[model samples]
Target: MMDHTDQTTVLTHAGVMAMLAAAIAEAEATGQPQCIVIVDGSGELLGEVRMTGAKYLSRKSARSKARTAASIGAPTTAIPDAVRAPIGAATGGEMTALPGGLPIKVGGVLLRGIGVGSGSGDQDVAVGLAALRAIRAATEF
Candidate 1:
């Protein structure tokens, strides 16, 4: 038997930086600045970036979005409207019902979550998606 042993994949600094770069690039192409947050599977921050001209307060929401995505292994928007408020209150707003958060998976392993804020929901999601795409090449074996 394996005797209570397990394995896990984690995000690296380089991977986090690559994702940040992708998010920033997407934001630029869309003519919007954003605050992007990256978290590990356990909802711990690995990296974050607040682009110039982004709303400063958006960083808080971005962090919540990233944590929500990592904790649920799904987009933060997946939280049902009825439960969203309760969940947020229960967790002291650690979770959010935003559309900008995405689970970061590579080769079937859920390694991280990325969240973008300070733009429209669609724009935030686009930036998050671009970040995910950029990390695939860097993280996938």
Candidate 2:
């Protein structure tokens, strides 16, 4: 039996909107067309965006970041490639082998969510990070 108390809250629609806007703003500023995704603490989809001219694969890549963050409760980037490489393969067709996903938290309790952008791996990660910053400043949790 799973304990509900241990489960993390999912990001709401409003939360998703905020996250997407921040990521979009950042990606636009960088002049890098990309995709962005925000997931709940539990790794559920909260929000997602694919920029104009972004590659078709950006959507799946963004979702992969969200899943990684939610599942580990940490920035997906923090995980070593060795661990991620296998997990990516283990998931078979579902997992995306890409960078640019992060998990949001507050004091030990997971409240915030993660974001992922589609671009170069580094650029995608940067956009996601910026969204996290925006959420932290604008929301209570």
Candidate 3:
């Protein structure tokens, strides 16, 4: 291995905007204004949105969900139920067990994470999926 690491792929500003746009559209289509958050694989925030009528506190939860997905490379729901509370407490609630968070994987490379809130879990998941589909068309790892 080299002494230093090689450069890694990152989502561009345009890409993040595309994902956010898609997520917002999905939320509107479902008639649930939502708070959506996206994070890079390193758990750095990229983009976010709080649509009209969305729950104020849901933004925090959405960020937690995005960070959770980025940290774990899986949906927030993947956290084992037995350890969910412990993990949340350990992380100071930085991670979540809700169903809205999903990893943005393309051709097996985890690139980003998205979380949507202020709606039912299913609706949130739907919004996240829409975001993923945006980048899916542009890149596959």
Query: What TM-score does each of the candidates earn?
Result: 0.91, 0.79, 0.91
Residue 26's lDDT within candidate 3 is: 94
Question: Can you tell me which runs of candidate 2 are displaced by over 4 Å?
Answer: 1-10, 93-97, 111-113, 138-141
lDDT of 1 by residue, 13-122 (tens): 98789889989999999999999999988888899999999999999999999988888878889988899999999999899998899988776777788889999999
- Candidate 3 ranges with C-alpha deviation above 4 Å: 1-7, 138-141
Tens digit of per-residue lDDT, candidate 2, span 1-141: 876676544456876787778888888899898877776655666667788888877687777777777676666667777776777888763444466767676546655445465578888888887777776743332
How many residue pairs clash in each candidate at the backbone level? 0, 0, 0
Q: Residue 88 error for model 3, in Å?
A: 1.0
Q: Which pairs in model 2 have colliding backbones?
A: none
At residue 109, what lDDT does model 2 achieve? Answer: 65
The candidates, ranked best first by lDDT, are 3, 1, 2
Largest lDDT belongs to which candidate?
Answer: 3
The regions of model 1 sitting more than 4 angstroms off are: 137-141
RMSD of 3: 2.1
lDDT of 3 at 71: 85
Sort by TM-score, best first: 1, 3, 2
